[model samples]
Target: MALTQGIPNNIYGLHSAEEQFREKACSIIDADTGLQLHLAVTEAAMDMADVLRQFDTSDEDLKVAQILGMRTFNAFGASIKLTLSGYHQNSALILRDVMETVFLLDLFAGDRLLIERWRFADKKARMRDFSPVKVREALDARDGFTSKKRFEVYELFSELAGHPNMKSSWMMRPQRDGDAVIGPFMEATALEAVISEMGRLAVQVGEKLDHFFPANWDQCLPSRLAFTQLKLKWIKTFYAPAGGP
Candidate 1:
Protein backbone atom coordinates (compact mmCIF):
# COMPACT_ATOMS: atom_id res chain seq x y z
CA MET A 1 0.00 0.00 0.00
CA ALA A 2 1.20 3.48 -0.86
CA LEU A 3 2.13 5.34 2.29
CA THR A 4 0.20 8.41 3.38
CA GLN A 5 2.80 10.84 4.75
CA GLY A 6 2.66 12.16 8.33
CA ILE A 7 0.49 9.16 9.23
CA PRO A 8 2.10 5.86 10.27
CA ASN A 9 2.87 3.95 7.12
CA ASN A 10 4.06 0.78 8.85
CA ILE A 11 1.65 -1.19 10.97
CA TYR A 12 1.80 -4.62 12.56
CA GLY A 13 -1.20 -6.98 12.17
CA LEU A 14 -4.13 -5.37 13.98
CA HIS A 15 -2.69 -1.88 13.72
CA SER A 16 -2.80 -2.07 9.91
CA ALA A 17 -6.55 -1.57 10.10
CA GLU A 18 -5.98 1.98 11.34
CA GLU A 19 -3.31 3.36 9.06
CA GLN A 20 -3.31 6.99 7.94
CA PHE A 21 -7.00 7.52 8.56
CA ARG A 22 -6.78 11.03 9.98
CA GLU A 23 -4.18 12.22 7.45
CA LYS A 24 -6.14 10.78 4.54
CA ALA A 25 -9.41 12.16 5.89
CA CYS A 26 -7.97 15.64 6.19
CA SER A 27 -6.58 15.42 2.67
CA ILE A 28 -9.99 14.49 1.29
CA ILE A 29 -11.69 17.23 3.29
CA ASP A 30 -9.11 19.80 2.22
CA ALA A 31 -9.60 18.95 -1.44
CA ASP A 32 -13.37 19.15 -1.36
CA THR A 33 -14.48 22.48 -2.82
CA GLY A 34 -17.95 22.12 -1.35
CA LEU A 35 -16.49 22.47 2.17
CA GLN A 36 -15.02 25.94 1.75
CA LEU A 37 -17.53 27.33 4.20
CA HIS A 38 -16.42 24.82 6.81
CA LEU A 39 -12.80 25.62 6.07
CA ALA A 40 -13.52 29.33 6.41
CA VAL A 41 -15.22 28.75 9.73
CA THR A 42 -12.20 26.84 11.02
CA GLU A 43 -9.94 29.65 9.91
CA ALA A 44 -12.15 32.14 11.70
CA ALA A 45 -11.76 30.22 14.95
CA MET A 46 -7.98 30.23 14.67
CA ASP A 47 -7.92 33.93 13.94
CA MET A 48 -10.16 34.62 16.89
CA ALA A 49 -7.77 32.71 19.10
CA ASP A 50 -4.99 35.04 18.08
CA VAL A 51 -7.21 38.01 18.81
CA LEU A 52 -8.22 36.70 22.21
CA ARG A 53 -4.61 36.23 23.18
CA GLN A 54 -3.73 39.86 22.50
CA PHE A 55 -6.04 41.33 25.15
CA ASP A 56 -4.27 43.26 27.92
CA THR A 57 -4.60 41.61 31.34
CA SER A 58 -4.77 44.78 33.36
CA ASP A 59 -7.07 43.52 36.13
CA GLU A 60 -8.56 40.40 37.69
CA ASP A 61 -11.74 40.72 35.67
CA LEU A 62 -9.81 41.02 32.43
CA LYS A 63 -7.66 38.10 33.45
CA VAL A 64 -10.69 35.89 34.10
CA ALA A 65 -12.32 36.94 30.87
CA GLN A 66 -9.15 36.16 28.97
CA ILE A 67 -8.89 32.76 30.59
CA LEU A 68 -12.52 31.98 29.79
CA GLY A 69 -12.01 33.12 26.20
CA MET A 70 -8.98 30.89 25.87
CA ARG A 71 -10.87 27.96 27.37
CA THR A 72 -13.77 28.46 24.99
CA PHE A 73 -11.39 28.65 22.04
CA ASN A 74 -9.67 25.44 23.07
CA ALA A 75 -12.99 23.62 23.52
CA PHE A 76 -14.10 24.86 20.14
CA GLY A 77 -10.84 23.66 18.62
CA ALA A 78 -11.40 20.22 20.14
CA SER A 79 -14.87 20.04 18.63
CA ILE A 80 -13.46 20.91 15.22
CA LYS A 81 -10.79 18.26 15.56
CA LEU A 82 -13.38 15.60 16.48
CA THR A 83 -15.65 16.60 13.64
CA LEU A 84 -12.76 16.40 11.20
CA SER A 85 -12.13 12.85 12.43
CA GLY A 86 -15.80 11.89 11.88
CA TYR A 87 -16.67 11.77 15.55
CA HIS A 88 -19.65 14.09 15.31
CA GLN A 89 -21.43 12.92 18.44
CA ASN A 90 -18.41 13.41 20.67
CA SER A 91 -17.75 16.74 19.01
CA ALA A 92 -21.26 17.90 19.81
CA LEU A 93 -20.74 17.05 23.46
CA ILE A 94 -17.65 19.22 23.51
CA LEU A 95 -19.70 21.92 21.83
CA ARG A 96 -22.27 21.57 24.57
CA ASP A 97 -19.56 22.12 27.16
CA VAL A 98 -18.39 25.18 25.29
CA MET A 99 -21.94 26.58 25.14
CA GLU A 100 -22.16 26.57 28.93
CA THR A 101 -18.79 28.26 29.29
CA VAL A 102 -19.78 30.95 26.83
CA PHE A 103 -23.01 31.63 28.72
CA LEU A 104 -21.24 31.84 32.08
CA LEU A 105 -18.51 33.99 30.62
CA ASP A 106 -21.11 36.41 29.33
CA LEU A 107 -22.68 36.67 32.76
CA PHE A 108 -19.35 37.07 34.50
CA ALA A 109 -18.22 39.69 32.05
CA GLY A 110 -21.31 41.74 32.68
CA ASP A 111 -21.23 41.35 36.46
CA ARG A 112 -17.90 41.79 38.23
CA LEU A 113 -19.40 40.32 41.41
CA LEU A 114 -20.23 37.11 39.60
CA ILE A 115 -16.63 36.70 38.58
CA GLU A 116 -15.56 37.13 42.21
CA ARG A 117 -18.13 34.54 43.25
CA TRP A 118 -16.98 32.16 40.55
CA ARG A 119 -13.33 32.49 41.49
CA PHE A 120 -13.96 31.03 44.92
CA ALA A 121 -17.29 29.18 44.74
CA ASP A 122 -17.36 25.78 46.45
CA LYS A 123 -18.65 22.77 44.56
CA LYS A 124 -22.06 22.84 46.23
CA ALA A 125 -22.35 26.59 45.80
CA ARG A 126 -21.48 26.34 42.10
CA MET A 127 -24.09 23.66 41.48
CA ARG A 128 -26.67 25.63 43.32
CA ASP A 129 -26.35 29.00 41.59
CA PHE A 130 -24.07 28.56 38.59
CA SER A 131 -25.43 25.51 36.85
CA PRO A 132 -26.30 25.69 33.17
CA VAL A 133 -29.97 26.41 33.86
CA LYS A 134 -29.09 29.08 36.41
CA VAL A 135 -26.59 30.77 34.11
CA ARG A 136 -29.15 30.99 31.32
CA GLU A 137 -31.74 32.35 33.69
CA ALA A 138 -29.36 34.96 35.08
CA LEU A 139 -28.16 36.08 31.65
CA ASP A 140 -31.63 36.29 30.14
CA ALA A 141 -32.83 38.27 33.15
CA ARG A 142 -29.92 40.70 32.93
CA ASP A 143 -30.65 44.11 31.50
CA GLY A 144 -30.11 44.91 27.78
CA PHE A 145 -30.92 41.41 26.45
CA THR A 146 -34.13 40.40 24.64
CA SER A 147 -35.37 38.47 27.78
CA LYS A 148 -36.73 35.69 25.60
CA LYS A 149 -35.03 32.30 25.76
CA ARG A 150 -31.65 33.58 24.69
CA PHE A 151 -29.75 30.47 25.68
CA GLU A 152 -31.86 27.58 24.48
CA VAL A 153 -28.93 26.65 22.27
CA TYR A 154 -27.45 24.94 25.30
CA GLU A 155 -30.52 22.70 25.63
CA LEU A 156 -30.52 21.92 21.93
CA PHE A 157 -26.91 20.76 22.08
CA SER A 158 -27.69 18.79 25.25
CA GLU A 159 -30.41 16.89 23.44
CA LEU A 160 -28.16 16.35 20.47
CA ALA A 161 -25.14 15.13 22.44
CA GLY A 162 -25.07 15.81 26.19
CA HIS A 163 -28.12 13.76 27.20
CA PRO A 164 -28.92 10.10 26.61
CA ASN A 165 -31.65 11.05 24.15
CA MET A 166 -32.78 9.36 20.95
CA LYS A 167 -31.50 12.27 18.88
CA SER A 168 -28.07 11.95 20.40
CA SER A 169 -28.00 8.25 19.55
CA TRP A 170 -28.99 9.01 16.00
CA MET A 171 -25.57 10.56 15.48
CA MET A 172 -24.14 7.08 15.76
CA ARG A 173 -26.99 5.03 14.34
CA PRO A 174 -28.32 7.58 11.90
CA GLN A 175 -30.54 5.19 10.08
CA ARG A 176 -32.73 3.41 12.63
CA ASP A 177 -32.25 0.06 10.95
CA GLY A 178 -28.52 0.53 10.49
CA ASP A 179 -26.00 -0.75 12.98
CA ALA A 180 -24.46 1.59 15.55
CA VAL A 181 -21.57 3.09 13.65
CA ILE A 182 -18.35 3.77 15.54
CA GLY A 183 -15.50 6.17 15.07
CA PRO A 184 -14.08 8.01 12.11
CA PHE A 185 -16.50 7.21 9.29
CA MET A 186 -17.38 9.79 6.69
CA GLU A 187 -20.83 11.34 7.00
CA ALA A 188 -20.96 14.53 4.97
CA THR A 189 -24.27 15.88 6.21
CA ALA A 190 -23.45 15.24 9.86
CA LEU A 191 -20.01 16.76 9.50
CA GLU A 192 -21.50 19.78 7.80
CA ALA A 193 -24.00 20.28 10.59
CA VAL A 194 -21.30 20.01 13.23
CA ILE A 195 -19.08 22.47 11.44
CA SER A 196 -21.97 24.85 10.88
CA GLU A 197 -22.93 24.66 14.53
CA MET A 198 -19.35 25.31 15.60
CA GLY A 199 -19.11 28.23 13.23
CA ARG A 200 -22.37 29.77 14.50
CA LEU A 201 -21.48 29.46 18.20
CA ALA A 202 -17.98 30.72 17.50
CA VAL A 203 -19.54 33.92 16.27
CA GLN A 204 -21.36 34.23 19.57
CA VAL A 205 -18.08 33.68 21.38
CA GLY A 206 -16.53 36.52 19.47
CA GLU A 207 -19.41 38.74 20.43
CA LYS A 208 -18.95 37.84 24.08
CA LEU A 209 -15.28 38.59 23.96
CA ASP A 210 -15.93 41.81 22.15
CA HIS A 211 -18.32 42.86 24.86
CA PHE A 212 -15.96 41.76 27.56
CA PHE A 213 -13.24 44.00 26.18
CA PRO A 214 -15.20 46.98 25.01
CA ALA A 215 -12.52 49.54 25.79
CA ASN A 216 -10.02 47.22 24.17
CA TRP A 217 -12.39 46.23 21.40
CA ASP A 218 -10.02 47.58 18.80
CA GLN A 219 -7.67 44.76 19.79
CA CYS A 220 -10.14 42.42 18.11
CA LEU A 221 -9.74 44.13 14.79
CA PRO A 222 -7.82 41.25 13.31
CA SER A 223 -10.40 38.71 14.46
CA ARG A 224 -13.34 40.69 13.12
CA LEU A 225 -11.41 41.32 9.93
CA ALA A 226 -10.64 37.66 9.47
CA PHE A 227 -14.29 36.69 9.97
CA THR A 228 -15.44 39.35 7.52
CA GLN A 229 -12.89 38.31 4.93
CA LEU A 230 -13.86 34.67 5.27
CA LYS A 231 -17.55 35.48 4.90
CA LEU A 232 -16.91 37.56 1.81
CA LYS A 233 -14.74 34.85 0.32
CA TRP A 234 -17.37 32.23 1.04
CA ILE A 235 -20.01 34.36 -0.63
CA LYS A 236 -17.78 35.08 -3.60
CA THR A 237 -16.76 31.46 -4.07
CA PHE A 238 -20.03 29.71 -3.21
CA TYR A 239 -22.63 32.39 -4.12
CA ALA A 240 -23.86 32.39 -0.52
CA PRO A 241 -26.23 35.01 0.78
CA ALA A 242 -24.53 38.33 1.49
CA GLY A 243 -24.64 39.97 4.91
CA GLY A 244 -23.30 43.35 5.98
CA PRO A 245 -20.58 43.56 8.58
Candidate 2:
Protein backbone atom coordinates (compact mmCIF):
# COMPACT_ATOMS: atom_id res chain seq x y z
CA MET A 1 0.00 0.00 0.00
CA ALA A 2 2.99 2.25 0.51
CA LEU A 3 3.34 3.26 -3.12
CA THR A 4 6.18 5.66 -2.46
CA GLN A 5 8.29 2.86 -1.06
CA GLY A 6 11.49 2.41 -3.10
CA ILE A 7 10.60 5.42 -5.22
CA PRO A 8 12.94 8.31 -4.50
CA ASN A 9 11.32 11.05 -2.43
CA ASN A 10 13.23 13.58 -4.49
CA ILE A 11 12.38 12.30 -7.95
CA TYR A 12 10.55 15.52 -8.64
CA GLY A 13 12.83 17.74 -6.58
CA LEU A 14 14.75 19.17 -9.46
CA HIS A 15 11.61 20.32 -11.25
CA SER A 16 9.62 21.69 -8.32
CA ALA A 17 7.90 24.91 -9.26
CA GLU A 18 8.43 26.31 -5.78
CA GLU A 19 12.19 25.75 -6.10
CA GLN A 20 12.27 27.47 -9.47
CA PHE A 21 9.88 30.30 -8.67
CA ARG A 22 11.43 31.04 -5.29
CA GLU A 23 9.44 34.06 -4.10
CA LYS A 24 7.72 34.81 -7.39
CA ALA A 25 5.76 31.58 -7.70
CA CYS A 26 2.05 31.66 -7.10
CA SER A 27 0.61 29.58 -4.29
CA ILE A 28 2.07 26.10 -4.51
CA ILE A 29 -0.48 23.46 -5.35
CA ASP A 30 -0.77 20.59 -2.87
CA ALA A 31 0.00 17.47 -4.85
CA ASP A 32 -0.33 15.26 -1.82
CA THR A 33 -4.07 14.94 -2.29
CA GLY A 34 -3.46 13.01 -5.51
CA LEU A 35 -0.76 10.78 -4.04
CA GLN A 36 -3.06 7.78 -4.12
CA LEU A 37 -3.72 8.32 -7.82
CA HIS A 38 -0.01 8.44 -8.51
CA LEU A 39 0.49 5.35 -6.42
CA ALA A 40 -2.13 3.46 -8.40
CA VAL A 41 -0.47 4.36 -11.68
CA THR A 42 2.98 3.41 -10.34
CA GLU A 43 1.77 0.14 -8.89
CA ALA A 44 0.12 -0.89 -12.15
CA ALA A 45 3.29 -0.16 -14.11
CA MET A 46 5.48 -1.99 -11.63
CA ASP A 47 3.14 -4.95 -11.84
CA MET A 48 3.62 -5.06 -15.60
CA ALA A 49 7.36 -4.84 -15.22
CA ASP A 50 7.34 -7.66 -12.69
CA VAL A 51 5.36 -9.90 -15.04
CA LEU A 52 7.61 -9.15 -18.00
CA ARG A 53 10.75 -9.83 -15.98
CA GLN A 54 9.66 -13.38 -15.27
CA PHE A 55 9.42 -14.23 -18.95
CA ASP A 56 12.39 -15.43 -20.99
CA THR A 57 13.64 -12.56 -23.07
CA SER A 58 15.62 -14.78 -25.47
CA ASP A 59 12.62 -14.94 -27.76
CA GLU A 60 12.57 -11.98 -30.14
CA ASP A 61 8.87 -11.26 -29.73
CA LEU A 62 8.96 -11.41 -25.96
CA LYS A 63 12.12 -9.33 -25.93
CA VAL A 64 10.57 -6.56 -28.01
CA ALA A 65 7.37 -6.62 -26.01
CA GLN A 66 9.35 -6.40 -22.80
CA ILE A 67 11.31 -3.46 -24.15
CA LEU A 68 8.11 -1.66 -25.11
CA GLY A 69 6.53 -2.48 -21.76
CA MET A 70 9.54 -1.12 -19.93
CA ARG A 71 9.44 2.06 -21.94
CA THR A 72 5.76 2.44 -21.12
CA PHE A 73 6.51 1.93 -17.45
CA ASN A 74 9.23 4.57 -17.50
CA ALA A 75 6.99 7.04 -19.24
CA PHE A 76 4.20 6.38 -16.77
CA GLY A 77 6.55 7.13 -13.90
CA ALA A 78 7.90 10.24 -15.59
CA SER A 79 4.43 11.58 -16.25
CA ILE A 80 3.47 11.14 -12.61
CA LYS A 81 6.62 12.91 -11.45
CA LEU A 82 6.10 15.75 -13.87
CA THR A 83 2.52 16.20 -12.72
CA LEU A 84 3.62 16.24 -9.09
CA SER A 85 6.12 18.96 -9.86
CA GLY A 86 3.43 21.11 -11.52
CA TYR A 87 4.66 20.33 -15.00
CA HIS A 88 1.33 19.09 -16.25
CA GLN A 89 2.05 20.04 -19.85
CA ASN A 90 5.18 17.91 -19.89
CA SER A 91 3.26 15.12 -18.23
CA ALA A 92 0.59 15.26 -20.91
CA LEU A 93 3.21 14.95 -23.63
CA ILE A 94 4.69 11.92 -21.90
CA LEU A 95 1.23 10.41 -21.62
CA ARG A 96 0.92 10.73 -25.38
CA ASP A 97 4.09 8.66 -25.75
CA VAL A 98 2.63 6.17 -23.27
CA MET A 99 -0.49 5.88 -25.41
CA GLU A 100 1.57 5.06 -28.49
CA THR A 101 3.64 2.53 -26.58
CA VAL A 102 0.47 0.80 -25.42
CA PHE A 103 -0.73 0.48 -29.00
CA LEU A 104 2.61 -0.94 -30.15
CA LEU A 105 2.70 -3.33 -27.22
CA ASP A 106 -0.63 -4.74 -28.35
CA LEU A 107 0.47 -4.87 -31.96
CA PHE A 108 3.76 -6.65 -31.27
CA ALA A 109 2.03 -9.04 -28.89
CA GLY A 110 -0.25 -10.22 -31.69
CA ASP A 111 2.30 -10.34 -34.52
CA ARG A 112 6.01 -10.95 -34.04
CA LEU A 113 6.85 -10.65 -37.72
CA LEU A 114 5.74 -7.03 -37.78
CA ILE A 115 7.98 -6.25 -34.83
CA GLU A 116 10.92 -8.04 -36.45
CA ARG A 117 10.51 -6.07 -39.61
CA TRP A 118 10.17 -2.85 -37.69
CA ARG A 119 13.29 -3.61 -35.71
CA PHE A 120 15.41 -4.47 -38.77
CA ALA A 121 14.26 -1.63 -40.98
CA ASP A 122 16.30 1.58 -41.29
CA LYS A 123 15.38 4.17 -38.68
CA LYS A 124 14.22 6.71 -41.24
CA ALA A 125 12.42 4.09 -43.25
CA ARG A 126 10.78 2.80 -40.15
CA MET A 127 9.59 6.26 -39.25
CA ARG A 128 8.00 6.64 -42.65
CA ASP A 129 6.54 3.16 -42.59
CA PHE A 130 5.15 3.30 -39.09
CA SER A 131 1.51 4.31 -38.90
CA PRO A 132 -0.36 4.17 -35.61
CA VAL A 133 -3.73 4.62 -37.30
CA LYS A 134 -3.19 1.61 -39.51
CA VAL A 135 -1.84 -0.39 -36.63
CA ARG A 136 -4.89 0.39 -34.48
CA GLU A 137 -7.20 -0.54 -37.34
CA ALA A 138 -5.42 -3.84 -37.87
CA LEU A 139 -5.53 -4.54 -34.13
CA ASP A 140 -9.23 -3.72 -33.99
CA ALA A 141 -10.03 -5.96 -36.93
CA ARG A 142 -7.99 -8.83 -35.61
CA ASP A 143 -9.16 -8.62 -32.00
CA GLY A 144 -12.72 -7.31 -32.46
CA PHE A 145 -12.02 -4.51 -29.99
CA THR A 146 -13.08 -1.09 -31.16
CA SER A 147 -10.43 1.50 -30.32
CA LYS A 148 -11.27 4.31 -32.71
CA LYS A 149 -12.84 6.45 -30.02
CA ARG A 150 -9.95 5.80 -27.67
CA PHE A 151 -7.46 6.78 -30.34
CA GLU A 152 -9.40 9.94 -31.08
CA VAL A 153 -9.33 10.98 -27.44
CA TYR A 154 -5.62 10.21 -27.27
CA GLU A 155 -4.91 12.30 -30.35
CA LEU A 156 -6.97 15.22 -29.06
CA PHE A 157 -5.23 15.25 -25.71
CA SER A 158 -1.82 14.91 -27.34
CA GLU A 159 -2.43 17.81 -29.67
CA LEU A 160 -3.69 20.01 -26.85
CA ALA A 161 -0.77 19.10 -24.63
CA GLY A 162 2.04 19.08 -27.21
CA HIS A 163 1.16 22.04 -29.38
CA PRO A 164 1.86 25.72 -28.67
CA ASN A 165 -1.67 26.80 -29.30
CA MET A 166 -3.74 29.31 -27.32
CA LYS A 167 -5.73 26.63 -25.48
CA SER A 168 -2.81 24.99 -23.69
CA SER A 169 -0.64 28.11 -23.51
CA TRP A 170 -3.04 29.71 -21.06
CA MET A 171 -2.12 27.16 -18.46
CA MET A 172 1.31 28.72 -17.91
CA ARG A 173 0.69 32.35 -18.76
CA PRO A 174 0.51 35.18 -16.24
CA GLN A 175 -2.57 37.34 -15.88
CA ARG A 176 -2.69 41.05 -16.79
CA ASP A 177 -3.04 41.73 -13.08
CA GLY A 178 0.56 40.47 -12.56
CA ASP A 179 -0.46 37.16 -11.04
CA ALA A 180 1.78 34.26 -12.01
CA VAL A 181 0.13 31.11 -13.28
CA ILE A 182 1.48 27.61 -13.22
CA GLY A 183 -0.71 25.29 -15.14
CA PRO A 184 -1.48 22.80 -17.74
CA PHE A 185 -3.43 21.84 -14.67
CA MET A 186 -4.45 18.24 -14.21
CA GLU A 187 -7.45 17.68 -12.01
CA ALA A 188 -7.61 14.63 -9.79
CA THR A 189 -10.57 13.32 -11.77
CA ALA A 190 -8.72 13.75 -15.06
CA LEU A 191 -5.57 12.16 -13.64
CA GLU A 192 -7.56 9.19 -12.44
CA ALA A 193 -9.10 8.74 -15.88
CA VAL A 194 -5.74 8.89 -17.61
CA ILE A 195 -4.07 6.46 -15.23
CA SER A 196 -7.04 4.14 -15.44
CA GLU A 197 -6.74 4.05 -19.21
CA MET A 198 -3.03 3.35 -18.96
CA GLY A 199 -3.63 0.46 -16.62
CA ARG A 200 -6.42 -0.92 -18.79
CA LEU A 201 -4.31 -0.78 -21.93
CA ALA A 202 -1.47 -2.57 -20.17
CA VAL A 203 -3.83 -5.32 -19.01
CA GLN A 204 -5.26 -5.60 -22.50
CA VAL A 205 -1.80 -6.15 -23.94
CA GLY A 206 -1.14 -8.80 -21.32
CA GLU A 207 -4.39 -10.51 -22.21
CA LYS A 208 -3.45 -10.54 -25.89
CA LEU A 209 -0.15 -12.19 -25.07
CA ASP A 210 -1.96 -14.71 -22.91
CA HIS A 211 -3.79 -16.01 -25.95
CA PHE A 212 -0.45 -16.64 -27.63
CA PHE A 213 1.46 -18.10 -24.65
CA PRO A 214 -0.92 -19.42 -22.05
CA ALA A 215 1.64 -21.27 -19.95
CA ASN A 216 3.89 -18.27 -19.61
CA TRP A 217 0.97 -16.10 -18.50
CA ASP A 218 -0.53 -18.27 -15.75
CA GLN A 219 1.96 -17.24 -13.08
CA CYS A 220 1.55 -13.51 -13.67
CA LEU A 221 -2.21 -13.31 -13.91
CA PRO A 222 -3.05 -13.32 -10.22
CA SER A 223 -0.96 -10.31 -9.31
CA ARG A 224 -1.85 -8.38 -12.47
CA LEU A 225 -5.53 -8.99 -11.98
CA ALA A 226 -5.39 -8.01 -8.31
CA PHE A 227 -3.69 -4.71 -9.04
CA THR A 228 -6.06 -4.06 -11.88
CA GLN A 229 -9.08 -4.58 -9.66
CA LEU A 230 -7.61 -2.26 -7.07
CA LYS A 231 -7.07 0.39 -9.74
CA LEU A 232 -10.59 0.00 -11.03
CA LYS A 233 -12.06 0.40 -7.57
CA TRP A 234 -10.16 3.62 -7.08
CA ILE A 235 -11.29 4.95 -10.41
CA LYS A 236 -14.91 4.17 -9.74
CA THR A 237 -14.85 5.63 -6.26
CA PHE A 238 -13.18 8.93 -7.04
CA TYR A 239 -13.83 9.41 -10.76
CA ALA A 240 -17.19 7.93 -11.54
CA PRO A 241 -19.93 10.54 -11.55
CA ALA A 242 -22.48 8.47 -9.64
CA GLY A 243 -20.10 6.34 -7.57
CA GLY A 244 -17.93 8.92 -5.82
CA PRO A 245 -20.16 9.04 -2.75
Which one is best on TM-score? 1
User: TM-score for every candidate vs. truth?
Assistant: 0.74, 0.65
- The C-alpha lDDT values of all candidates are 0.70, 0.60
Q: Which digits, one per residue and each the tens of the lDDT, describe model 1 over residues 1-245? A: 66576746343522443334446556766777656565565567556655767766677766777788788878887887777666788888998877787788778768878887887889999988998888888887776567455566776788878898777777886455677775555456677678767766666676576666455467677777777676656556655457834
Off by over 4 Å in 2: 1-38, 140-147, 170-222, 231-245
* Model 2 agreement with the true structure over 11-102: per-residue lDDT tens digits: 56544543444222122223433445445545665566657766765677567677776676677778656654456567677877866777
Count steric clashes of candidate 2. 0
Q: After best superposition, candidate 1 residue 80: deviation in angstroms?
A: 1.4
- Candidate 1's C-alpha runs over 4 A off are 1-35, 56-58, 143-152, 174-177, 214-220, 228-245
For candidate 2, the lDDT comes to 0.60
Clashing pairs for predicted structure model 2, backbone only = none
